[model samples]
Target: MARSVDTRGARPAACGLQGLPGAWRAPFLECAMTLAAPEPATPMSAGLFADEAGCPRCSWCQATPLYRHYHDHEWGFPVVDDRRLFEKLCLEGFQAGLSWLTILNRREGFRAAFARFDAEAIAAFDAQDVERLVQDAAIVRHRGKIESTIHNARRVLALRREFGSLAHYV
Candidate 1:
């Protein structure tokens, strides 16, 4: 009882970015479209690995130390903390055009640069903050992504007030 998935025009609702304003979400659509497209059919199993690892993981995560550690320690694990959730959101935005490993290596730098991902704090980041972040070497210095983080922080606060928590909202 298997049905095929039509990856074309697939909605990005699953990524939770659908409701965001166009300007806020425009940059992500290309990435979403790329992700939503179906890969060439392969006779492969999704859970191709499991055993002493304690959980089955997607094959892509097997490639590097950072991905493996993230898969085992963080990925797919339930996240309930608001700050961590906010951090992940910003990190994913920063992840555009960059490898996740780059972000992982600079996670602490991001935390420090963004005031530990406090929504209220980030929402209040002035122009000076944006300029400083652009010059920060440890983290990605893309100005647009830095500004998006601040914009998204304000959005997070609104969502939090409406939904009780960003985790709940997400």
Candidate 2:
């Protein structure tokens, strides 16, 4: 039998194999088990957990500042504006193989590299501009996404001309 340390009874006695007295057994055992067990992860994304009021803890969002900000501030929000919708479509497409945090962090660079995501401006870009964008390090340099952005911009422009606005068209 292992004897437990006693410091004027302030410290709880260990619940040995037979367990401590009923008064102390359950609570002491619980505390000991709790201390040894991993704490449950608290949710952080409010939109993900309705019962938690949107602050659902997500394993992917562990501790990165950019990820936390995007998760809390931007995820799941709908867009109705043509320009904004176009921008998000391009961004989400660009984010397909990469992490959203990477895209979020480089968003400003993307805006700069893509001419602020302006539909007309991007639509005006030629092969020369495509080459320039490929050389730019600020944004993701993937050729497919880069070319797709141009194609999408043209699509948006056509939609705008036809429907008076992409919002109404969509």
Best by lDDT: 1
Cα RMSD to native, each candidate?
11.8, 17.9
* TM-score against truth, every candidate: 0.68, 0.64
Q: Considering summed lDDT, which 10 consecutive residues are worst modelled in model 2?
A: 1-10
> Which structure among the candidates has the greatest TM-score?
1
Q: State the number of backbone clashes in model 2.
A: 9
Candidate 1 worst ten-residue window by lDDT? 28-37
- Which residue pairs clash in candidate 1? none
Determine the C-alpha RMSD for candidate 2 after optimal superposition of all C-alphas.
Answer: 17.9
Mind giving the per-residue lDDT tens digits that candidate 2 earns over 65-141? 67655543344434566767788889999998898877888899999988888999999999999999999898999
